[model samples]
Target: MPKWRIGYRTLKTAIGAALSIFIAQLLQLDFYVSAGIITVLCISVTKKESVRASWERILACLVGLIYGSIVYELIGYHPISIALLFLLFIPTAVAIGAKRGVVTSVVIMLHLYTIEGVNVEVLINEILLIIIGVGVALIMNMYMPSNEKDLTWKQVRLEDCFRSIWKEFASYLRFGDNSWDGKEIADAAAFIEEGKEMALKNVDNHFLRNDDYFYHYFKMREKQFAVIKSILPFISTLDRTLIQGEKMASFMEELSQAVSPGNTSAYFLVRLNELRNELQQMELPQTREEFEVRSSLFYILHELEEYLLTKKKFKPDPKRTKTVSAKRLNRDHEQRDTK
Candidate 1:
């Protein structure tokens, strides 16, 4: 859900509580008693930890009430003495950290000492009202529970990683630029790490309902990531070869077309398999010369073949050109233009 909607719901619940208290006051009920009930009900209906909060509030108020009664009996009826008694519980209230508990305790103590009736009837009413508030809170919470469910953390992490992989592969296919954006790669890597962590969290050490789907998705994603990771350095080499007037234009044209789904060459899968195998053994080239020489049309063909075979091994067509001479013609045209 949108954050704004969540905020609005919280606001609405608080307003509803205030309105309920107002209505209760109009019916000649004690405002403090009504306010306590409204507060508990509001928290119960709107908050994530409503039941726990209500329980804590009830416990804190009970403690405060006991403390207040003890102080009232010991300190007698001096205004200053009652005030001091109330002040003594402030530290305990602060420790408990319940707004309702502190307010209710202070109000009840003030009413007990200052009000004309210093009997057990007032204390009983106060306790009964607090109990009613808690009961109302529990009843409301049972009827309107929080709208959240337990999700398998492992499945979620795996799904996230798979989505990242899909995006990365799609981006690479569209751009023909093998170089991955560091940020995007980092995000995908993080998701993969999170998935690993979630995998460790499994008690039964088994796949859940969505786990199999995620596993298949993860495998596809890993394959795509590997292809891009291998091809990035070779892409720069191909560009350099074009700059050096290398005549592999037809070969590149065939490879580029094969990379596209429509009009894909019959030998495309075979060539991709060869490419994949070569990449598995290939070391990272430190020099530009190594990059260019090691990633020539012949090497690329082998790498492409291996890549395809990893998915599925297939036959290569003999008619496919290993190299093309269009770059030579392009270089001649450039020379003529320079002259």
Candidate 2:
């Protein structure tokens, strides 16, 4: 039974449509069913999107009503008029920022043309129906269930991917073999991008001025991942016998364990600095080939520093584990109040 249940947002949207349909019917609107259809069309995953959709729909509705009436009057409700209406009026609506409302505009044009004439009474009826449909959708979406946990879940998965990738890199450094498929790198990248998008959407779902902590977290990781990618080719060429290769391998193995939101990058930062200083203090390369390998080792240490500092930007609160988004929002609100 739970599996068959509709999502909370979808259920709310359906109820919104039902209420609009009832109101339109009670008022005896000519195309009463259109109200319900509009509600369905306007329901979006976030409140900001719902508002944009409503604006586009209403704008397109107006554009279609005005030009559609003119076309209907000139060409007498024929197929040629319909074709002309779409080609001309649709582009005009897009130019006016109603691209998402093209279908809704077409429906409105068809409705007007089917009625065969436009009068003050008919135009007012359409306007009232639009109000009911868009207004009800707004009411339904003005609030949302707290979704900080969703962001937290996404963050954990993303970190897990990062950890896995690092472990694979460490394995390659230790064995000097490409036994592990590189698919997890792409998967982790895709997850990071997806997590960022979801976090931004979560931010828009609320009216409160909350910071999107997860979005920033993913962005930081993405920057660090870029450095990691740059170092991979160097890792591929080096053997365990090369300078710092074994040490770096050991570093990655331990680093992978701290890849969670609660862990700070300070420990890793200190360790990488120590490694960099140690590498600099070593005697100059005895051979030309050793010089290149030594240079690559130094470069890898610099990249590791960049990667670690990126993770240090945020101070993750353990309390954020529960209702993170809401808490951040409230914290911001209080800060504003204090100021």
lDDT of 2: 0.81
Best by TM-score: 2
Write candidate 1's Cα lDDT for 75-98 as tens digits.
Answer: 776786567776777677677766
Cα deviation of 26, candidate 1, in Å: 12
- Give candidate 2's TM-score: 0.82
Candidate 2 lDDT at 247 equals: 84
Indicate the residue-level lDDT of 19 in model 2: 93
Write model 2 residue lDDT over 1-339, tens digit each, in one string: 457768888888889999999999999998988888888788888888889999999999988889988888888878999989899987898799999888777777788888988888888888878888888888888867766666676666666677887898888888876887877678778878887888888778866676677777778878977987898888876667854888889899899877776656888888888888888888898988888888888888888888888778766766664454455457669989999
lDDT of 1: 0.48
Residue 244, candidate 1: Cα error in Å is 21
Backbone collisions counted per model: 25, 0
Off by over 4 Å in 2: 1-5, 143-145, 167-187, 314-318, 321-339
